[model samples]
Target: MALRLSLLLLLAILPCIVHPISAAANGRALAESVDAAFWLYEAWPRSQKPARARAPNGFAHHLRLGMGTPPLNSTFVFDTVGALPWAQCQPCVHCLPQEGAIYNPLKSTSFVNLTCPSAGGTGCPYNFSYGGDAFTSGYLATETLTVFGRSFKNITFGCGTLNQGYYDNVAGALGLGRGNLSVPNQLGVDTFGYCFAPRATFFFFGSPPQLVPNTIAATTPIVENPALPSGYFVRLVSVTVGPTSIDVPAASDLLIDSKSPFTFLEPATYALVREALVAQLKPLKEASSAACGAVGLDLCFEADNSTNATPPEVTLRFDGDANLMVSEYLVEMSSRRLLCLAMLPSSKGSFPVLGRRVLMGTPVIYDLAKNVISFQPVDCATFGATFAR
Candidate 1:
C-alpha cells in the first residue's frame, strides 16, 4: 500500500553559504555552490559489539537522508571506493535485518524502476561483491533524494532486496567513489570534501568549505589505478615514527579508504612499525593475545590510566612533500585498561589501506577537476558552523 500523502514533508538539511571566489583561488571562473551536507555517525555503536566484532572503532560511519516524495528517512554508510548507492528495501527475499524502516518504493510516487536493455526492458539488476563473501544485489531504481532540506530529482540508487556481510547496523551505503554512478558524479560535482570528528561532522558536496586564512594545508596528486578504477590512490614516499624512519619503498600507492576501520600495512612494513612503537612504549606492558586478538589486531597494551606513557607520533610522507601526521597510535579498546594499535598488517597481499583513524580531525578535499586531494587540520565541530555563514 502507498503511504499517505501530505503537503508538508519536513526535512533537516543545512543550506550552504553561497559565495563567490576569484578564479585565481578556485581555478575556475564560477564557483560551484555547495549542494548538500550531512552529519556523520558511527555505523556500529560502542555499547553493542558482538564478541567476534570487538573493534572499538568499527571503522564505518553513516549519514541520514530523506528519500521519495513523501520523504522516507534513511541511513547510509559512505564508501570511498564503492560505486553504487543502495539501501535495504521491502520484499525481503534474502536480506539481513536493518536498523530502521526499510524503504518501500511502491509507497513513493517519485520512484522510478530502471530497465535493462539486456533483460528485454525488464527491471535492471545490480550486484556488488565486497569480498569476504559480503555482497548486495537487487534492482536499480531512481528516486528524489533529499539531503538536509534540498531535493535532488531522479537520483539513481540500488533498491537492495538481498544484502549480507559486515554492514554493521546501517540501512545501506553511499558510493562516493570515482565511478559515473557514484553520488558525486551523479550530482555533477567535480569537488567534494568531508571532515571527520569524533562525534558529529559534515560531508560536503560541490565546492568545499572555505578554510580559515593561513590554515596549514597539504595537497597531493591522486593517481589513477586502471585495475581498481573506483579507488583513490596517493603516492606514499615514506613513513616515520618520531625521528626514526620506517623503510617503505618510495612512491608506494596507498588507497585512502574511509570505510575501512583500521589502516592496513604490508606485513614486512608493519613489523618495522610495530617494533618501533614497542620500543617506545617500554613502560607499558603488552596486552594478552586474547585481548588483542579479540579485536583483530596484532599489537595492544595494558596501560595505567594515569601513566604518562604515550604512543609515538607517526608521519606519512606523500609525494610532493605532503605529510600526514598521526599523534595517537594505540587507542582505548573496549575498556580503559586495554589499548590497541589502530593499524594492522595487511591480510595476505592486499594493498595498504589508509583508514578512518588517521583521517579524524582532518578535513579532506577531493578536487576531481584538479586531480588533487587536499588536507587541512581543523576542529570539525567549529568548522561545521562555518557552513552556515
Candidate 2:
C-alpha cells in the first residue's frame, strides 16, 4: 500500500515539473505596448489670456480615438495634465456642438453606465473646469476604448451631457494625468512617454517603453501636494538667461501642464525673467521695433528662419539639477514672425506653469513607481528608429 501511494504522488508531481506556470505572467495582466502618432493643429481662442492666446495660430493638439463597440471614431484633445477622459454623449441635457457625431450609449453593445457606488464611490455626476472657462459636467461611465490598435475594455470615463468650453474641432479631451481614472493608471501601466514636434507627436503607453539610450539628460521628483493632487508639480530651483539666474523660493511649485499653450510665471518671477531677457536682447541688431506689450506678448522681435537671427537660450533648472534649455526662437510667434517670450504672468496667483511651447522636441517620461519625471532633447524626426528598440 505504501509503495503504491508513493508512485501515485510522483506521477502527480511530474506534470507540474514539466510545465511550470510563470509567476510574472500570473502577477499581472499583460497588455501590448501602445506606440502611436497624431497630428497637431492650431486652435485660436477668443480669450486673450497668455495661456490661451500665446500660440501664434492658436495651437491645439488632438488625436483620433475609437470608443464603444463598432467603434465610433472621434477626435479628442490629447491633454496630459487633465484628470479624466471625457467625450460628448447622447441624451444630452446640454451638449456643445462637437465636430463629429456624438457618442450614443444605446448604439454601442459594450456601453455601461456606472453609478456612484460602482465608480469607486466618487459619485456618478462629475464636473471638470479648465483654463479659458472650459467646463464639462456629466455622468461617469465605462466603455471600450481603442487606440493604437489596442482595445481596452471597461474603461472608466466621462460621458459629457453638459459641456461649456472652447474645444475647437475636437469632440472631447483624453486625460493622461497621474490619477486613478487617467489612461496610464487605468491601463495598469507604470510608464508612459510622449514627444511633440511641429507636424506630429508620438505617444507611448506600456510597461517600460523603449527610449533612446542616453537620451534622458535629467530627472526630477514629482511631488504630490495635498491642495492640488491632480496636477504634476516639480520643484523649480531657478531660471537662467545668459549670465542672470533668478532663484525661486523653495516653497514655490511649478506645474508641468501640456494644455496651456504658453508658459506662465509668477508675477514676481515674471518681472525678473522679463528684465533679464530684455537686457540680453538689447544688443541684437536684428531686433524689430514691434511693441512687445501691444499684441499681448511680453517681448516681440522680428526674426525669420535665418541662422543669424537666432534667439538667446533660456535655461530652467529644476530640483536635482534637471536643466531644460529652451531656444530663444521657440518662444516666438510663428505666424506673426515675431520673436516673443511665450511666457506670461499668472493672474490667479497659482503656481508657475511650464507649457507646450517649452516642451517641444523633448521626450518626457512619467515613471509612476519611482515618482519621477525624466526628459531629454532629441531629434524628433528619428523617433521611430530611436524608440523602436
Candidate 3:
C-alpha cells in the first residue's frame, strides 16, 4: 500500500564505497579524484523495526562508514538537509541508543580535535539543529574516514558528545547539505547523484557516472533561497493532478529533500491537490481521520466497492518544462480496504517539499558546480542489477 511505502521511505539508509584515486602514495595528491558510491538498504526493516510506526522528522535513509586509525565501523543517517556530519562519541554526556559501539576518540591514533574557526569559541565546537528539539553538539575533529575498502585521511567530522531526539537507529547523521562543512563541500565534490531503488539505492559522489544516457532527463535549476541557504530548491511551475493543472505560486519553490518520507505542500496547494484527487475517486468513500492517523497519513479513502480502482496520475511541472509524472501516489491498503494519498500539508503551511516517495526509482543528479538537478524515469531494478556490487 502507499502508506507502507511512504513510511518505509523514512525507515531505510544507505552504504557507501569511496573510490580514492590517490591516498598518501608516492607524493601524489591525497584523494585527488575522490568519487564515492553507496549501497542502499532499508534502515528499519522487520528485524530492525522500532516500537513506533515512524520516527519524528523522519530521516529514514542510513549510511555505513569506518572511521579512526584501526577503523571503527559506524552507522549514520544520510540527511540532505542537515548541515554537518557528526557521530556519537564516547564519554557521551547524553546520547541516543544506536546499533554498534560508539566511537572512542582515545582509541584512535589519527583523531585530532580541530581548532574552532569562528570567533567566541576556543576549540572547533559545533552545534547543529534539525528543527524542533533535535540537536547535536560537540567539537569538530578529523579522522581517517573509510568506505568500502578505500580510506580518506583527515576528513573533518563532528565528534558529538551530546545528541538528542529520534536517533535510536543511527549512530549519527551524514550531512549532504550545501553548507561549507557538508560532505560534498568538504570533499570538494563537484557533482553527486542518487539512483533510488527498492532495497538497493546507488549514490555516486564526485563526477557521477552517466545514469540515464538515452532517457529524456528532466533538468531543473537549483534555485538558491537566501532564507534557507542549505536547501536544494527547484522552480516549480505547477502540479497537475489527472487533467487538472494546479498552478503554483511563482514565489513558491520545491525542495528536493531525502530525509523526509512524504511530500508536503502549502495549505492552499494541498487542499487543491486533495480536492482534485477526491473528485476523480467519487466512488470510494473518504476514510476517517482515525484510519489515516493510524498510519500517520492524511487524505485516505475507503475502497470496499472498487476492486480494480487505479490511483490518479500526478505530475510535477518545473520551470524548464520538465515533468515528473508520478504513477503511485495513491497507495491502497488491501487488508484495511483504504486508498491514501502520500502527500501532506506543510506543518506551518510554509514551503513545499518533494520527498523520497516521489523520488523512488528515479536517477537524480545534483550538479553543485553547475547548480542543476537532473532526473529521469527508469526501471531501478534493472539499473541496480546492472550496477550491483
Candidate 4:
C-alpha cells in the first residue's frame, strides 16, 4: 500500500542539523519544510528467466506508483544506481510485454512533451543501457506524478518509445540515484532511506527518522570520485568472516547498489573471502560439494533446515567505524534443501558491488548534502513504524 506522510515527525526536531536545499528557488522552501515527505510503498524482488535462460534467484525489487492525470498506476523496479525514471510510452517502435497497460501520454491531460533547447536542448532525448544488452531509448517529458493522495506537478521523466530488457512484469523503473534527474533530486530532498526485508521493503523519499536507540548505527563518508559520480561509493577497508579479517586493497572501492541481487567482489578479494568461508565451513564439506552440483551455486551445502543452520557471521568494514554485518545464511536453494553463498566475483576489472543480499534487514540512510551514508541493523518487520508519527 502507498502512503503519503509528512516528514515533520521524522525530521523536524531531529538532533542532527538537516541540510539546506541547493536546487532551484521553488525547491528552497520544500527543503526547509518539515511537512515535506513522499509516499512510500512495499517492494519485492522476483525471479524470472531472462533471454539467456539462467534464472538467478532474486533479480530485482520493484515499487508501484501512480502517474499521469487520471493516475495510471504501474510497477517500477527500484534502482538506486540508476538516474532517470522512464516508463513505456505510446507509439512504441518495439516494446516488451508488460503486466499492465503501457502508459499512453495522450490519455493524460497533464502530460507535456519537452522539446529542443528548452528542456535540456535539442529534442531532449535520453537513452539508458544496462548490462546484458538491455536498453531503453526515449525523449524527455513532464507529467503529473501522484503517489498516495499527494500530487507532484510537472515532474520530469522519460517517455520511452523503444524499450527492451529483462523487466519481468513491471512497466518501467524508478531511479533513486545521485543524478540531478533522480526521484530524490526531483523532490528536492537531500536525504532518502530504505529498509529491505524479505516480505516487504520500505522506502522513504525525505529525511528519515533518527536511528532507534540501541540500534547498531554506523555512519561513513561517501567517496567523492569524479570518475564514478552517480552511484553511492563507499570505501571498503576490510572484510571479516568468522574470526578472519581480510584487508582490502587501498584502491578497491565498493558500490552499494540495489539493482544487483547478489554481492560481487573483485577477483582477488573474492578469492580471499571464499577461502576464508570454506575454511570456516569445513565441517560441512561433504554436504557442500554435493549441493553445489545440484543447485549450481559456487558455494553450497545441504541443510536439513536452513532456518536452524548456524551460518558464520560476515562483516564488511568501511573506511570509518561503519561495519555492515550479514548474519545467518546468505542463499537458500528453493528447488532443494541447500544454502549457498550469495556473493560472486566481479566481472574482470569492475569494482566490487554490495548488493541486496548483504543489505537485507538493514536500514540505510543516504545523506546527500553531508556526503555520508548511515547504516543500522533493525527488525525490518517493524521498521515501518518510524514512518508513523
TM-score of 1: 0.83
- Worst 10 contiguous positions by lDDT, candidate 3: 1-10
Instruction: Indicate whether candidate 2 or candidate 4 has the larger TM-score.
Output: 4
lDDT of 2 by residue, 45-141 (tens): 3232211111224465666778999888787887777777889998898788876799999999998775544445554667777745777778777
Q: Which of the predicted structures, 1 or 2, would earn the higher TM-score when compared with the native?
A: 1
Residues 1-389, model 1: lDDT tens digits: 11111100111112211111211222221123333433222322332311111123445766667888898876677788887678888887777766678888889999988765555676777777776778888887888877655677767778889888857676788888776456776666687877766665567766655677756467899988865677898987778986689868445677888888678877777888888888887788888888888877889888664176766678877777788877545677656478888898877657788888887767788888878887765666656666766
lDDT of 3 by residue, 24-108 (tens): 1311223254634443333223233211112323246566778788888777776777756789999999988988899999999
Clashes of each: 4, 1, 10, 2
lDDT of each: 0.69, 0.65, 0.67, 0.69
lDDT pick, better of 1 and 3: 1
lDDT of 4 by residue, 102-219 (tens): 9999899999876654343445666676656688878878787765446777666778898887587777878776665677766778788887776667777776666586554778
Give model 4's TM-score versus the native structure. 0.83
